[model samples]
Target: MRMVKVEASVSLRRDLDTGTEMQRDAVDNIITQVIEQGDHALYTLTKTLDGAELDQLRVTEAEMEAAYAQMDEELIGALREAMTNIRDFHQRQLRQSWLTTKEDGTILGQQITALDSVGVYVPGGKAAYPSSIMMNVIPAQVAGVKRIVMVSPPQADGSLPAGVLVTASELGVEEIYKVGGAQAVAALAYGTESITPVDKITGPGNIYVALAKRAVFGKVDIDMIAGPSEIVVLADETGDPGYIAADLLSQAEHDERASAVLVTTSNELAEQVSVEVEKQLALLPRKDIAAASIRDYGVIYVARDIAEAIHVVNELAPEHLELLTKEPMNLVGKIRHAGAIFVGSYSSEPVGDYFAGPNHVLPTNGTARFSSPLNVDDFIKKSSIIAYSKEALEANGSKISALARLEGLEAHARAIDIRLEGNK
Candidate 1:
């Protein structure tokens, strides 16, 4: 990991601008082709990028059943437990339509409705993310989404991952497709013969997937254009170097583009952590990927004090912020931007990523400054409802007509005029 002196101007905006513009253009091309060519384009892109021959794009019932039967009892039990916790967390976020009436018989309320259908994209091939299956589907399920369709790239044998199938089945997601990447996104955005278009698509994926989601934003709602996984640890003298090193590596191992940074007031702890990272990197199976991530994006910044460290953290707006100081809670109030805050040494990033109740699918590339983590709220819409009795209309009609006329909307004024005339 590189040691950089913490600068006052360093902020999340700086980090957001790090990716190459050429990558963005390449992603745009995928989106253009997917939109124009539809299913045929999806198949061609899949074969070219995934290096997998494709015949059928959707998963069969037999495969789902076989996957359920193949899974071990222990693994099934664990998935069931995680599902329950996730369900409970999201269930608390569910809201109902409400109405209120006044003495004049005026009624107003907000009607909360779940989405009709949703699509979840899970990465396949070398990266089979069953955790993503749980994170994306559970909220939609909790929000009462009627149809939850899933898309993933198929294996060379054109088979869905057993773990993915098992997870989807457990979550009651009946519609699973084997298509993935930008093409699968296209299929979800616009209906193909084999796949139904969804109201919204949510999940994490490669740059192509992110760019595809950006392209199809108006066509379908997306959670966010998530970038690589990231973690920023704010520690003090009391924080453990070993624990800090372990937490940093947890995110770095995700991918070569992933970032793990440390901002500390103590230089002694920084040196200890720098050494500990090297020692721990040797034991990791993904050492090469983690090392590359560390070499490129990782940093240890020595701050003048904890306040400066906190300032830097807020500016960064990291996806996962770990506060490892003596009084983590005291600093919590100071944190203005972060996808999720892990308060103490025990509250590591992985805990939230896997077993913890909070959603792991979070805003990346400093998007936490304005965006949010995926939640049950993402799957529901709110509609405002208003009704007025004749007496109530008589009371407010003049003001309504005046305001509408002032805005040069004569039709709106005429509508109110008609109501008033009926009352007279």
Candidate 2:
């Protein structure tokens, strides 16, 4: 970590951008092949891209049973506990189809309906992310979505990770597939003989997965396009230098592009955290990766006060934010942006990533300014309810026509006119 003095009029969000070629050509080529060749393309691409040849695309019932049976009781208990927490949290976010009546006999409300099906993409690259299975599947399950299909790259042995498979099975995700990358996304977006097309897709992945999700948008709903993992810690004089350094490294080790920034009011704390980060980074197994991330993108901004630190935090809109000041709760109301806020040193960012009830699939790359963490809402659709009584239509028909005609849409105005005539 390097210390940088926050200057007036200087933008702190300069690094908050992803210009990866969108892997557009490769994504387009892969998606085209999947649409053109169906299951064969999935099979061929798995071997070509992931270097794992798979005779089976779907995880078999036997595989699910084996994964469960092989897992130790401790892991099973931990996963179940985490799943329960996630399920309980999302259940609070579940909405019901509502209809409110009016004296005018005009019924207007929203009908909340679960999507028919959804696909969850779990990355199976260097490590197994069993937490992704819980975070992605539980919300859809809580939203009353009928079908949830899960896809992930296979291990080197061409089998689904036991942790991922067992977790998915425990959470009632019955349709698990052993396919990944842009090809898997194509099969989910547009249907194949083996895998059915879904109404929406959710989860994070590599650049190819992100590009594929972008390509398939409008064709199939997708969660926001995720960029590299990032975390920005906001601290004041009372903050712990050790806690700050360890927390930032948690995200830095995820990828070389992943960013870890510390914005503090005290220059002394900034230097202390930089030294602490180096001391901790030396002992990490992924030190090289974290070092590259810290060397290339890591930064510590010295602010004049808590207000200036908060300003930098809002402008950057980091994926994860930690408030290590004496008054984290008070400052939260002033924050306009940030995907997730971990108050105090006790509320570490990974708490939400795993066992905490909140969804870990959050917006990144300054998107937290507008987007939200994944929730049950992502798995459901809403239809505006409108049942106009004859009296109500008569009361508003002329006004509706005037507004429509003002927009030069005669047909829109005529639509109301025809309905008025029909009632007459």
- Top candidate (lDDT): 2
- Give TM-scores for every candidate, taking all chains together and pairing residue i with residue i: 0.92, 0.95
**Stretches of model 1 off by over 4 angstroms after superposition:** 5-9, 12-41
- What count of clashes does model 1 give? 0
Report clashes for each candidate as comma-separated counts: 0, 0
Q: How close to the true structure is residue 140 of candidate 2, measured as C-alpha lDDT?
A: 93
Error of model 2, residue 13, in angstroms:
4.9
lDDT of 1 by residue, 1-424 (tens): 7777766344333344323688777667777776677777777887888777777777778898888788998998988888888888878888989999999999999999999999999998876687899999999989989999999988877788789999988888888887888788888988787787999999987767777788789989988877778899999999999999999999999988888999999999999999999999999999999999888888898999887898889888999999999999999999998999999989988888777778999887888889888999999999999888888889889999999999999999999999798767
Alpha-carbon lDDT of model 2: 0.89
Alpha-carbon lDDT, every model: 0.87, 0.89
Deviation from native of the Cα of residue 196 in model 2, angstroms: 0.9
How well is each residue in 117-190 modelled by candidate 2, as lDDT tens digits?
99999999667899988888899989988899999999777888788888888887888888999998999999
Model 2 misses residue 88 by how many Å? 1.2
